[model samples]
Target: MSEMIDENAGGRVVVVGAGPTGLLLAGDLAEAGVPVTLVERRHAGRSNLSRALVVHATTLEAFDARGIADDLIAKGAPVQALRLFDTAVVDVSELPTPYPYLLVVPQYETEAVLQARLDRLGVVTRHETEVVGLRQDADGVALTVRDADGTREERAAYVVGTDGHDSSIRRLLGVEFPGHTVVASVMLVDAVLADPPSLRIATNTDGDKFAFVAPFKDGYHRIIAWDQSHPKAESEPVDLDEVRAVLHATLGTDFGMGEPRWSSRFHSDERQAEHYRAGRVFLAGDAAHTHSPAGGQGMNTGLLDAANLSWKLAAVLRGRAGDALLDTYESERYPVGTAVIKGSGRLLRAAQIKATPARKLRNLAMHFALQRPLVNRRIGFALSGLWVRYAAPAGAHELTGHRAGDVPLTGSPSRLFEALRGGGFVLLAPTELHEPAAEAGVRTAVPADGGPVRLIRPDGYIAWAADTPGAEEVALAIRASGA
Candidate 1:
């Protein structure tokens, strides 16, 4: 971690961590006209190990809202579907998303795109900067940071911690990371394959061991294997030979490795912060939650965290809403993060079951349950994150007080979200009735076949909607939401 910023500089919303989550939040904050300074413990624009490889549909849609997914796709691979080859080769293509297959992009490239976008939005990140601690009062939070050379103190109206699992911010806030760790430790290696296997993502089982491979750019592949029974010599560095041996033992054959790029050992831990906020400081991404990489959900959840928090932070900064809006961040996201951790952990347990008639029966039941389009849609909804619905406070109106699920809109702009690009509140009025919205100071967009009033938030969810022929009720709901 680098030194803190100078308190006398100016008012800045400090963001800790320059990873994808931080960059995305910074971009949103900048676009919302908030003065944001991102602090990273390393040099800026430095690419680290290419770890995460899958971008969920929710993340893709979130990036689409930011208009940066195309370039990311060009820089990485696109997986259109996932196939499970246990007992039967089941094609999970009919999942309930426009994006059924995951996006196979290296973590480094994803960060690059996010950083570039943040730069375009006029947000500068300070590298070699780390927050040592933070103190909060009635006004704001003061952060102590250590730079490459020295240390200093910086004061900010707000702080966001997007750091990894061992978050300094979480510690400063005294939040508990509650969860259990997996028994077996697994090693992951990224290598240039001499004969790269034609696999986008594969799970192969050999005897009691398993190897999972995911392809990446430049003929590199990330491989994972677990052989806890075979003890290794202490202090011996992991080499290509050892990696190849694990591969052969787990996958029945080794495709051969060129030069091993990166390798690390990790035991899965399913944990999430007790809370995401303390005084003027907030938490996002891994700082808020973490879990096993069962379905490649860590990065996806982190990205969604950025998306969810960014607009709300902007709302508070711009004075479009009250501090109460910020409180909803934890209420809305914490359960989702917990669900991801639990759901993925459950799947991992199911996968690790011994192959027997009983295990087969259990797997069959799971498969059958997932075979239903509605059930699969729910799973996809959970994975894609569209299913996240905030609990509206008591007495809040229905349509304008909660998020609107994506509904088919027969309109001029086509999709239901074409009218909400500026990240501002919008009031959709019936074309036949051009009455003023009830109380929300929002731009008016008439649905082509307008029959109802729809008030959408900047995050692409309908705050309050109604089938009424006018916008007055919708406006009233927006006002109820503190618009």
Candidate 2:
């Protein structure tokens, strides 16, 4: 095998799997002036089939930081609330953010947007390429890749696997993916429905069966249904008849479904890597974790994983941060992945209740709990990903490690997320502190009247904040964040 060495290999990143996670992460690195190479096993063509259909509010906010949220929002339908069973509803209209609803776009559409960004940034993706082997040393990583031409070895300072559940990189690293199957023989289909449900998202269960239906921008509906009484093997073929039967049984009508474009039968497993990082190699998206599709958190969680890791990788490679900054990627994201796994599993188990009395009780409890405003808002925030926060140190500010929402600012950028477009820390402080903040290697903005001084990370989280503006403290915080 021939060895291909990049002149800038010491500062380069090799990303495996050109899915949304890898695409977004590569784009972020390229935008930040870090060299990135994206590799994928699939041929270079956009496919219509997709398993993920929901984009949560927090993910949209992340896209907004990259200046691509508007483009993606234009390609999907937004649902203000999600209906679970006949009685419970989780409304997201009152969330304190620009995007207060869930965008129901196909996974392919999201991938297309990210791919466009990567193309604009001149980041070429190597398709029809697969990773056959991996090795890492103290200095960098070496990967064995196979393409149509031949097999070769490529080197990079770091390697990230955004590959799906059966990640070759994870296997090569011998990382343990521990979890069990949540449900078997789940049916997924994309079809044109003659009559669609009035609700933007329709989901319910009738004890033995459960189904979920959401609209696509192209007049098709993505349906996921399961029948506990008639479990089928993953190899069994799923046709329109079987899908129609389950939808009819669970949703009370198939909505005259016909002309299926895609269908499949698969099992849902709740698995997470024992560790996200192994020396110079890391895992993100489905490579790091996989969970039931109850709350549609799989892809959203993966995209967020890429967002969390991209900036850190860029910072370290660019010499703006030390290697320890890379460790935060796993510490900050592992707990979120674990919580999503458990949360989605709970939703799946709740929907799978098979007894009449138990189902009634489950629905009643959900309905009663959702009626309270506090509980309703909390559920909305959790599902939309706004409730996520990293662990903060004892003496840190209250806002530290929390997401910095799109608050108005008295400056040229005029918003917190807009300032993040430059891919650096942003300090929202008093006018008198602007020069000092700028000297600390961060963009400075004047906050609206009476707002506290804050240092926002490139990914839109509050790295540090203070009610009382102190130049020393501000500079120290920015330095501490490895800016």
Candidate 3:
């Protein structure tokens, strides 16, 4: 990483927060030979307090494009279906992607994979360097960073804030984080179980208490419990006794919860930043949106945000895309963020229904809805992020803006994703078609279908397609991608 540092510091981009989102974005930029500096406030170490635990299909596709998804799948537990209330389940086995289920790995493991990718690219992360404030004009962004050494200025062509919920960069940019608390004083505990539940997931409620238990990849369990009757502040201490009480009250047993390693009290909120971009600065991950942990979508959403933005940033920086390409990041991600917040909020509200009759009605309705394979499949698609697709422009091809499934490429016998090894677009065209500009960051491969031509973005979305694609279609897609 030291040797790979950019010679022209002023021309490089700086990413705040060395979390999963920042690391992935930095790796994407660096892999494309774009100068990037990743800054973090904490020393690098895997956290025992694993927050996000489920890696969905969309995220797996993103990782697979980087050639690390299979390795990550090897290191985690796979849950084929997510058990909702006793009557319903989100069967991910019906998903359209190769990864038809969720990988139950801790957040730390995700971070480690990304960190390794960054290291391989020689993109060193400057830890303990926190962005205190920032100011930007026509030229670049000047950050007020503080570390052990003291405060100093660091400049970059553009800055991205992937910092968590309470992001310093978001505040410095004067963005409004608008939303309300979904679950107050929710207790979280990571513990070993001498007598574990027969099921990998257990969720139930009794009277005013609610409890959920899901096993980690390591066989340990993470328990989340909340009690409407027992009001407490988020800072209040959480203990094994309190956990046992809540679990017994809600789930009829504690599953022999003992030997706690990490415990805390937190509140889930349904909120999103009013703006993801402000001039030259931008936000991704928790810095942009957050919501109830009911659907386990925060991390997945953030990672997708990074994947969408990184390519545009790289394209803009490399002079392959225009400045307008950056605008699409917010335009695309903001709606996805809004959808996540709404979906998670719905789940939280259903779980928090205090009245017994209301809970019964909700359960019955959900069960009836999930009774059909089509409905269940739709639910799986949404939770697993496979449901996400961009809006198609008028008079565009049918597949335009649709999520590009991994299709077998011509000649090489590899898939379209394999051609993305260099972090650029992959244009599939017949030998007769001509697209000279496609050579730069665009891999010209034979179409899997042996059909018409297609332009796939780095993040695996079809931008343009035609029966007889030429330089005009390729050029239009590149310009649309801001490449």
Candidate 4:
């Protein structure tokens, strides 16, 4: 760790990790012309561990709004729908969105896409660098960092901690990470198999164990199992032999377990930081919440956290909004993080319970509930995060609590997101008034295919939609989005 102090260093926003959350936030900040310096303890590139696999539809839309979904598709596989099974398989189609199922992409590939975007935005991540300490007064944050050779100090307008569960920033601030362990040790298996299983892989369960397998490369699979009361072996390489045994016992079939690529064991834990922001220092992703991977919410939630916070940070850094805008980072995300932790706990218990007669009866009842189209759609919405609608602040509007899906035009679909690419408020109007709307700092388009007027926010949600409304309605939406 370097120990040289340059406390007067300034202008850049110091980001404390280069994972997906940090990289995505840095990209947005950099694109907004906020000088950003991202620091990471590890060398640049994705970790070998196969952690998160499912990218929910909300995240897909977030990526698509940035024009990166095509690149993501090139890097991973796309499933049309997720198949749930208990006594039988239930297919839940007719989900409200265009993406009805989760996109199965490795976390590394997801990072790769974001990294490329970061490169395009001219943001450089300082690898092998660690944030040792930080202090904030009324003006800005003063941060101390150490690299391989020596220490250096830099001052920044704000700091964001995207570091993982044991975050140094969170520790430095003395924020209590409150929660309990899920009481299960899980083995993760990463391997390239000669042949792959045809099972639909989100999460699978049997007696006393939970199994999850996701495809990575053409022949690679990431497998994980939760063992409630298994004995630990002392071998250093994570006891690949034990991992194979657990997979074989639970799945009741051969994994085609080829030479292992990477393997590790981790205990399930559900924890969240007491506060996401303390003056100039803020937290996002796992730095704010750590939970079981039951719903594949860990990385997804973190990515969304980055998305939600970046716009606010950029707004304040650019002096367009006051620091009070940044305060909403915790107000909007803390409850969502708490809900995710609770939701994952329920799903973990539901999936891994020992099947007695009573358990079987409960499973049957759940299956019956899932059989209804409406119930299945609701479950899909929950799993995909489309059901989450943030509360609008006072005097917002009547169109406050909607997810802003696509609306079709005369011959094609008009995506509400196209208008929100630059992360600002937009007001759509009748074709006749497109020029008038442009004077209000709202980008005007004719919707070449002839659709109704719409309004989109920088976060890619529809702020307002109307049937060829006049300029007065468009002005109201602009005010609603705080333009």
Candidate 5:
């Protein structure tokens, strides 16, 4: 038996997998004064071969809450429109948020920003340590992990597996990940294109092939190409010639692509765990759900999952809320995961239509729908994750569960997201209500326009709101939120 290390002194959280999801969750917890240990299987260094390539508007807003959005935005190109097929487009320029476009950057860049935050928070990340076994009881969870030295037991009050699709924590928890593979033998590569496409994001599909190209800040372009007619096994080696052939077939040119930095082949799966939580153990990111790469939502969704669960976990461990508050994590995120799976699956199926007539009809239908401003905005919002809203309790205000965008405030932190940087809730209300709101363990800010008193959760979602809220009524809502 491996020796056990009892580190559960102060409700320590052990976050498995140091990917963006795990890193963000750990940082959030640490920022909230929660002791968190981040463990990763990989060695102590960042990998350049990151799969996720775009950060959506919602994710940027989440980063803004942590004061890191500007750093990440400076590292990527802002794509205002996403082009599908030849005619259909999802325009995101008109979104109401401060960041209205998708920031196209490598996943490593995103991870770097989160890792830096973790470092500043004094959170320790144990790389090269892999979770091999897990067992949870009513009080806490025991994780068996292995590193170069040997296997040992690590204890934590709560465990979150932000590890990718094949999560060790989820597997040890005996959870069921039931879903199907959506795309097979998809080839991905990062290379320098001698003749780059004019569009920031260039994507097109012939009847038999599909290709997408988006640039990186370092001058390399990330390319994803699929040839349905000649489906290669994922184990087959992908070369520049094969990539060029598919690009040429779909985009009518290879754009002088060469000097491949990295290349790989893999299948995309649409899967979600049966439940995100089992006792003291929980799952986030790809461990909880995964879907097609269409819409660049995979990383974005996982980041949001971390954002939603972190504050709740902090509140529970800090004794501000009851354990039942933790249950809402899965309840709120599962539906969003399901929606992404279905929506992305529809996109992949549409893009994979092999028949010329079917392809033409798909393009025509999409083009027509996108031409309508409402339809275009809806699709853009969905893709950017700005349309996500949790279910509000009965009798709750209309704005409950909806995201509180960077609304202007009358206080020092002049925006709602800025107010969230203290790792607590914010009550935006009339100046008279500030006194009562302060007692609820939340920062108080007067709304610039003098609207209804709205209580915003740490994650930027509206928790409670009322046009005419008494002090006691506001206090009750805050206490219910465990703040």
Candidate 6:
């Protein structure tokens, strides 16, 4: 691993950011023997602010594919049931996966897990290195990086900007982040409440004000309160008194709130990048899109984006696939990003309803709808990301674009994700077809039911399915997957 930034390290792929998305990408690339370097502006030994707090089931399954899901689960607190609006609740204990509930852990804890995995993979992260500007060419892209010492230029075959919302690389690329700020001033703070409401989640609204309290693994709770009557700039300071007052005004009491830890103010926006790729450069995480924090979807979505792109980049660099393979990254993820932006924005709008009568009516409807077992199950599935499906090409197999969510592995105690640990597709067929390429990262498992052969992508999605598949069928699926 290259500890410090070296000049022109043989045209390695440069990942800009040390966040979870960038870490996953770099780790996956290096594990596949692709020379990659990660750059972050934060100083060494520095810790980032804890923002997002929920790691959804789909994301955990992605980590499971990479062989780090169990480690994260060991350190997180699971919430099987989530309370929303008023008396409505969503129980995800039976969400149909190895990880049935959303793991409630600070974003920093999630980052730490990725960091450790990167270290084990022998990936280096250069701190205090920021991407000032960049320009792409026919062959690759050139980045102008600034550090305390001076400025330098590094060329790479591809560059991915996984930086946060105020990404400098995204600005340099001149992509439009078109969206409006849904909330002007949102106050969020960490504190110890004498009377904690819920160990999982407590979210509700009173008139025009809303309050959400979620406990962390450290025995502290995060109080996110918003009052339309009190609009202030994000730069303004926040105080515990104000948090207490807002909680009291919105939730009828502060839950004996006191002993503030950290506080900040920020606004929520719903925006997505117009393009995920520009020449040899690509975007992921907050650089590609951003949305309101209503559903705790920000970090989870970014991690999934990294998972979707890492395999494609590794394939192209290793000469296993053609350049066109990279285009699928945008085509598949952009729609999901659009949906998250709209869905989370809609949730925020519902919570911020100004008219008291409208809010009451909406709450009544939600209460009735959530009471139905089918409706609750459906909501749980979607919110947990099990309902997310991709667009398949015309004439493709019926299950081509659907996820193979935790299928039982034949002749072992492991599941499908366990078979995908080393990275590549797993052929679940009824009989032994043929051995794939000696160098191909493919695994074969015969189902006990003697079902049709289904090609499962490294990201745990079905590429194609057929009653009988031979070497040619597997090769076609691999080519289509760019793996």
Alpha-carbon TM-score of each model against the true structure: 0.86, 0.96, 0.94, 0.88, 0.97, 0.94
Q: In candidate 4, what are the lDDT values of residues 149-210, reduced to their tens digit?
A: 89987788889999989899999999999988774567777787565656555444665666
lDDT of 2 at 388: 92
Superior candidate under lDDT, 1 versus 6: 6
lDDT of 1 by residue, 1-483 (tens): 112333344336889998788988888777666778899887755686565778877677666656786778787766654433243222335655455667777888899999888877777788988899789887778889999778888788889999888888999899898887753556678777677655556664433455677777577877876655553443445555666776776455677776777776666678888889887888899888888777778888888888778778766665567898889889888888988888888766765665567566765675686666677666666555656676765764565434443434555455544445445566666544334543344555666554457767666666766665444455456665544
Candidate 6 lDDT by residue in tens digits, 257-327: 87767878888778899999888899999999998888888998898888888878877776667889889
Error of 3 at 71 (Å): 2.3
Better of 1 and 2 by lDDT: 2
lDDT of 4 at 227: 59
Cα lDDT over the full model 1: 0.70
lDDT of 3 at 240: 71
TM-score of 6: 0.94
Give candidate 3's whole-model lDDT: 0.82
| Residue ranges of candidate 4 with Cα displaced over 4 Å | 1-11, 81-85, 88-93, 192-195, 231-236, 394-396, 407-414, 431-437, 446-454, 463-483
Error of 4 at 75 (Å): 1.7
Q: Whole-model Cα lDDT per candidate?
A: 0.70, 0.87, 0.82, 0.72, 0.88, 0.81
Backbone Cα, N, C clashes tallied per candidate: 17, 0, 3, 3, 0, 0
Span of 10 residues, lowest total lDDT, candidate 6: 1-10
| Model 6 bad stretches (over 4 Å) | 1-11, 46-48, 437-441
